[model samples]
Target: MRKIYNSYINNFTGLSKEIWLLSLVTFVNRAGAMVIPFLSLYLVNDRCFSMPDVGWIMTSYGLGSLTGTWIGGRLTDKIGFYKVITLSLFFGGLGFIGLQWLDSFAGFCIGIFTLILIADAYRPAIYVASDVYSKPENKTRSIALIRLAINLGFSIGPLIGGMIIASIDYSSLFWIDGISCVIASIGLFVLLKPKEKDKIDPDSSIKKEGLPPLLNKLYILLFIIMVLTSITFVQYFSVMPLYWAKEHFLSEDLIGWLMFVNGAIIVIFEMPLVGYLERINISKTMATFWGGVFIALSFIVINITSWSGVLIIGMLLLTLGEMIGSPFSSALALEMAPKGRKGSYMGLFSMSFSISHIFGHNGGMNLADTYGFDTTWWIMVGVLIIVSILTIWLYKLLKKSPTFEGT
Candidate 1:
């Protein structure tokens, strides 16, 4: 146990001071975010919310996230990254605490919206901070380490949530989540040191060569992909447990453990793999990763039998694919960003997921209700396959285009 803890601590040696600070923030924020996976369950099962009502509540959170991302990006540019991060943490932690007091539907909506608003605000600042702090050679790894910290936090959060929910009331989950944010807030405040300001390259010919406008096109394509992929990812939160409960006779305890397993695998392996992949052709690697997601999702489409062990195996595959796509897409978005517009650029990337959640969470529930989980999974698989093909096509097109920035 001591050796394991030491290994985890030593992982930071490869990262710079700012990157380490960002990692701490990511871990804590994600630890707080674990409340989301079981949030639907809390609403419907615990609070007796109707399906449509749950949709609206989640939609409100997504809408708030959209606004928050824009605001966060704008603030980071004018004020600075550390201020934005600190404010986000303080307010976000308050929002989590607020969840404990929310009993009515309106109260739930308000609480969730506030939480997402603050939480989403942290994203762009962290990204821009990573970009500012690291040299080009380590930029991708810095981002990956940030993600790894979040995933590691995610790994622990759900397991802890599971144990807490099993033993206590669902409301207790909020307190656990809120406290994590507070602890992380302290760490972030102490660790983040401002370095030299990163100014956009005014003389860089790329903006003049049409790179700025090209991002809008990539934005559209990526949005479609995000909507499709998020439908599958949201299942881990929204509908999958219900499906297993209704169709597979799986207990909530087992479901929680499965979710924990998903996070644990990512925590253990996502970084090493990302570090390795950073040295290779990122676009091609992501295309292949999405292909794997398509195949892993097919297991659900073709799923007719009930086997807990097999389901776990399928989840491992899905997570493997997710790990590949997450960091690759983030780096791509960072690369696509125009100078001085890092916030909006990151805002656009953040918005993709928010928009996707609007569809993926609420729309996914509707789809699962109208069709079955099996059919829903098939729809997701088909879209993922399409995304993989399109990503590859885009890669080829960018390679040939004279306007492409990063080779």
Candidate 2:
């Protein structure tokens, strides 16, 4: 037992204090992530919004996320990540406070859009901080640590949120979430020191020495694959809850517990899983391919069976995929970026997932509402297969590059 405990500690030994604190901040922020997970339910049940209305509002949030990440990257490069992260957290908390007052459709739309724009901007800044704080060999582990913190908090959030909604009201959710964000912002501000901003001017032409991230063909292919995978993966939040509640006849508490299970699995396994993947010399592309495949299988299993016991099996598969894919994808983005452009690369990568939210939530909801849940699941399976193929192609293409030797 001592040997195993020591080995576990050894696995996480090399990361910096900044990374640890950043992980803590991530935990605090995500622990309050009750809003997004329950947003669709709130809109449909509480606000009495139509499915289309829900889709549009979610799309608006996605658009805000897309815009926020892009602009945040530029700001992080120009002004420094410290300012960007702190400001994003502080103001994002205020946005949530504002959201509690808005009751109409337009007000809700505008409120959600503004809130996401400020809140999601923190993503790239955090990624940049993760990269800046850790050594190259520990990069993947560092990213995993951050994700572990996020999932740990996520596990807590929805469970507590379930109780909150059950006993209190949605207004309490916003207040709690908002307060959490502000506290996280204060923690970050007190802990993280200011660093020199990236020197490259955003408006200037790309130096002849290296291609800009936007023009890099390999990176673009990776981004496309991310979009495809996220489209399928996002259904867990967007439609799965609705399906469980409406179709499976699960209660709100039960649905929250299911979501908690997803997070709990990731928190338990993600770090060791990344360590094992790295030790085995698994390529990021291959990990991603298998992850995509597992995600598809998760939904396929759901399509084939309705047993509640089987649902845990499916959720396990989905969580396993997330454990494999998410951190390595971030590591790959950092590995591929030019010096001084990590923020931009991370931003663009963040945007890929954000962009998918637009299509995933809107498209998935539309299909489920119109065609049925099974149709949506089948479509997800088809999309994941294509994404897996693309990942394979990406792997082969990377094998030819000079950097490929190290990757």
Candidate 3:
């Protein structure tokens, strides 16, 4: 028993104090982000917006996210990550709470767009921060550790947010979310003292000949895969809440627990699994392929049975895929980037997710609102199959390079 405990804890070693501290800050920041997981619920239940209107508001969210990542990524490279993260968190938090005042469809569309643009800037900036803090040998594990904090935050947030909704009102979610973000911003200011300048080797750090990610054919294909994969994944937070309530008849708190379960599994197992995969020298893309396949199966499993226990089973498979797939996808993006262009690479990569939010939220809601829940799950399964096929193409395309297998 003691040996097992030591081995489990050992998986998390070899990271810098900054990554851990950043992880703490990320935890608080994302916990406040609980407001997002419940955004559909608020619009549908409290605000009484129709499905199409909610879809438009969410579409604005994706547009904002796309622009924000573009700006944040560029700014992190120019001004520095500390400034980007600090400013994004502080202002974005205020914007989230300020959203309580908006009512009309156009107002929500514009408001969510602006707020998400500011909020999502924090995404790619944190990716760059992870790169700056980690050593090459343990980079994937380092990212997994940061996600460890994020998943832990996600786990706690939904459970509490559920209880709050059950007892009080949705407005309370906005207040707590905003306050926690402000606290996280203050923590960032105190804990992560910035360097004189971002340290990079001058020789390697000079801009490479190809500054454009679109110019690289392999990368463009990879971007397509990421965008598709994210569309299927985005449905989890966007439409699943409605699916659970309207279809399965779950209460607010139960739906929260289900989401909490997804985060909990990732928090407990992702780091150790990443460590084990690295030690065994598995191909990163190969792991990602399996991850996509597992997630695809997760959606299929939902349609397999009417039992509530099926949700638990499906959640486990989904978590397994997420743990295996997400870090490697991130590490692969980092690996492909030239030394000086890490910010730009991550920005484009993060934009893939933003694009997914645009398609995923609006599309999933439209289908659910029109057809029913089962059709949406089946369609998501089909989309994920395309992601899996793209991953295979990327895997084969990289074989000519010596580092293809490792990357």
lDDT of each: 0.71, 0.85, 0.87
lDDT of 2 by residue, 35-125 (tens): 7788888899899998878888888888889889988888877676778888998899888877878779888878887888898889888
lDDT of model number 1? 0.71
Q: Candidate 2: lDDT of 321?
A: 87
Clashing residue pairs in candidate 3, if any? Answer: none
Q: Which should have the higher TM-score, number 1 or number 3?
A: 3
> Which scores higher on lDDT, 1 or 3?
3
Q: Judged by TM-score, which candidate is best?
A: 3
Candidate 3 lDDT over 115-162, as tens digits, reads: 989988988889988988888887898889888888999989999999
Local accuracy of candidate 1 as per-residue lDDT tens digits, 1-407: 99966655554446777677688777877786667878877788888987667877887777778778878977877777778888888778778877877889888778777778887888887888888777766777788788888878887777777778878778887877777787777777777655444342222222333244225776556555655566567666676767666777766566677777877887777776666565564563354446446445635633756665677777776777777777777776777666767766777677766766666677767777787677777777776777677676666656675655343
Candidate 1 ranges beyond 4 A from true positions: 1-14, 195-215, 282-302, 403-407
TM-score of 2: 0.96
Clashes of each: 0, 0, 0
TM-score to true structure, per model: 0.87, 0.96, 0.97
Name the candidate, 2 or 3, with the larger lDDT value: 3
**Model 3: worst 10 consecutive residues (lDDT sum):** 198-207
Q: Rank the candidates by lDDT, best first.
A: 3, 2, 1
